[model samples]
Target chain A: MKKVQDSSIAGERSVTGEFEILNQYGIHARPAALFVKTASKFSCEILVEKEDTIVSGKSIMGLLTLEGSKGSTLKITARGTDAEEALEALRTLMENKFYED
Target chain B: MNLKKALTKDTISLDIKSSSKEEVIEEMIDILVSAGKIKDRKSALNVVIEREKKMSTGMQNGIAIPHGKTDTVETLVAALGVKSEGIDFDSIDGKPSTIFIMTISPANRTGPHIQFLAEISRLLNDPATRQKVLTAQSKEEVVDTLQL
Candidate 1:
């Protein structure tokens, strides 16, 4: 479990959270797909940052380029009305190791 | 990360005959087998099928990336196939998939597999590249387009 930082400016909501990859295989195809699937459910714009590389959270290919291995840290930022919910969902997914070993 | 080096004419198919999801995947695996990249076709196919069952690799924009990790392969093996007619791959966007990229990697390693996927993803992310791949006339044309 990790803490999510929520902030809003000019009536727009933006939430950012950092999570560690605990799964043995890290963010492989399956985890990346699950992340995209969950992010696609919301209308907010989601961006995933690994190290310094950032890509759309809704894109499987974009996320794959991040090379998020085990123990790596990923920072996800969601901006829009549903930003908070989107981050929460993603946080849960990562905390659960994308439901993988 | 150089796909051009990993792929040959044998691993690239400009015209895919299969119209179903399972058939297309099998056809791609057969291509890899024909290229001598995969040793145990049954195990490779089974892993991809199982992974597909968990969640469709049929991504958005008429593209599908079906991949799996198995001990049957010593190194990462990949194949690219294009179906002009498009097949119903149960894609996330609900569109028929025309571009198929299938990969089978070693079960114990993850680096090379991820790198290969990243490279392919980068190539297919472009609309122009996708169009070229879909409309490619020959395997060499496909290879030239996928070069990165």
Candidate 2:
């Protein structure tokens, strides 16, 4: 998993990582809510791409379609003014294991 | 807008249990009905469930915001629930969640829905806030933490 430091690129800044959706049922209701909630934090235009599917990080419906299973690998890309901050924040969320015990 | 109008003390649940996402949505609908947030619990639940059939709402982190926009509601109302024991929510984090924030609103109140969602997202992203929420023992504490 490579964390892109420079988010100031003209086009979209991309960060790819393997996030294990630690929840047992795998990206169900409550977790989806949390993901949407977290994604709404940044000013950047965020997208989570899994397989061939790409979704707006801010949309609950869009996130749900990813079908993020346990131990799934996700490629999160951010664009816009605060893409760097958004990428860092998202990386924190994923690296912290989404705060799961 | 009116945060007071959006939430009532009665709409919150401290600890809740449900084996599956469907059951959790049912629980949220029941809470909405009891709080007078919605008219028909069954139909309201169906709306959320149908939406979930399209996609799972599990964002990373031990939190889930299951929401539905339907004409059945008069305004935007939210119900917050916490499961200390953790439930199998199939989160992107691959872990069970201890927190559940459920939002139900009229189809017209998109602005508040987005605003509220953003607020919750920003707060939960903070490690300190997430820690406080995880250790919170009561609904009021949970609300206070999120409201910050």
Candidate 3:
């Protein structure tokens, strides 16, 4: 099994990255806003899906609906002209826990 | 809506020729107006101003995204203003804003609006592309760089 979670398939504009929620409170309030704000800065369509449900990556309200707990693993996918950049941005944010404990 | 679908060739400008925040936004709105993307310029301007009052849309690294969501238009529209000299936009990073993407969308629409915003950010995130946009001599060059 490929332990790496940050790999993209060839020939498609879409890129995918997976990360586990590590923050004590998951993504709430400031973190969600920051996530949405960061996501909003890009031009690609980003999706953050957990389990089988998918949500728009740029909507704070939609992200909040996930109620992603501390251990929930998220599957982030981005498609469009800047899909790779969007995926990297989300990956950094999630890996760093949005820079919050 | 996809940025390419809404961002027409006429909506892009390589030179902003303005420094003030409001003036810059007005210039961008003008692009939308000429493209028939704006039905009410005054109302659309008012909405964008109101949104600024709520929070500064300026992103760091010399980028500002002034967006409005209202009935001023029934669909998503975008305009770009590139200022080589950069303008002080009160950005969170305190950097002069060189790229301003004026986005106007219908308040009732959902999903794609956020994606549009993300796409704009992602575009500027690339240093090479951002540099190309900043140095492009003409609107056509700017559009071509963005398409890259």
Candidate 4:
């Protein structure tokens, strides 16, 4: 039987980690904009994957397409220089619940 | 920041009489002014235009969210206008935008204003809600669709 992959990682420069959405409203326009703005600050290429779907971390539109409700698990990955820093920042944002009430 | 209060019949309009992107924004802001939502029309228009200069507020799927933070507004005031023929909002999708949501938020209360923008995004995302709002014939219908 064929099975689908929930998450995966490859390449030396790439760093990946899983984080759960804790905000009550999840990642809508405002939070997604904040995330994109943060991801754009780092030089590394970032991508966020939900289950098997992958989207550019720097694209506000792409992030919105995920329809990431609360409690959703997101896998974040980054590559290039400062990859570690970029991934850490994003993970921390999810951990901080996007500073939402 | 309250959608129920921010979006009223007086703020929603169907007959947006403007063609160009800049002019359309002028038209939308004028709605807020007439409704007494904006006291200083010139300053409010300038603030909204300044934000537009940085990046076109033209969102995809026939909607454009033009927003700015200024002290002229008491809290958060929103006006929704529909252009049946559509106008070039410089959207990333390269399509004409028919729905314009002009939001003027107070500078000090940005947190609630941001949450309101998120709410607008969620409302427009739903197929049923979007359709109803777009095809709304009366201002009352528009207000109903925006109600949470």
| Fnat for the candidates in order | 0.61, 0.08, 0.00, 0.00
Q: Which stretches of candidate 1 lie over 4 Å from their true place?
A: A1-3
DockQ of model 3 vs. true complex: 0.06
lDDT of 2 at B8: 59
Q: Which residue pairs in model 3 clash with each other?
A: A41-B121, A42-B118, A42-B119, A42-B120, A42-B121, A42-B122, A43-B118, A43-B119, A43-B120, A44-B119
lDDT of 3 by residue, B83-135 (tens): 98999887765779998888888887644566666566556666788898889
Residue A89, candidate 3: C-alpha displacement in angstroms: 19
lDDT of 1 by residue, B35-147 (tens): 89998989999999999999999887888989999999877788888897899998877889999888888889888877777788878888899999999888778778876
Superposing every Cα of model 2 onto the true structure, what RMSD results? 11.9
* lDDT of residue A34 for candidate 4: 67
Off by over 4 Å in 4: A1-101
- RMSD of each candidate? 1.7, 11.9, 10.6, 7.8
lDDT string for model 4 (B1-148, tens) is 3677688888888999899999998999989999999998988899888978766777666878887889987889999999978899987556799888888988776655555665676577666876888788888888777773
Which of the two, 1 or 4, has more TM-score? 1
DockQ each: 0.67, 0.09, 0.06, 0.12
lDDT: which is higher, 1 or 4?
Answer: 1
Between the candidate structures 1 and 3, which one is better when assessed by DockQ?
1
Residue-level lDDT tens digits of model 3 in A1-101: 00234444565477777788877667543455578778888898889888786877875545655667677888888877788887778778877888865
lDDT of 2 at A11: 67
Model 2: how far is B29 from its true place, Å? 1.4
Question: Interface RMSD value for candidate 3, one decimal?
Answer: 8.9
- CA lDDT of each prediction against the hidden true structure: 0.87, 0.68, 0.76, 0.78
User: Compared with the true structure, what per-residue lDDT tens digits does model 1 show for residues A3-82?
Assistant: 57878889999999889989888777788888999999999999999878889999887898887888889999999999
**Candidates ranked by TM-score, best first?**
1, 4, 3, 2
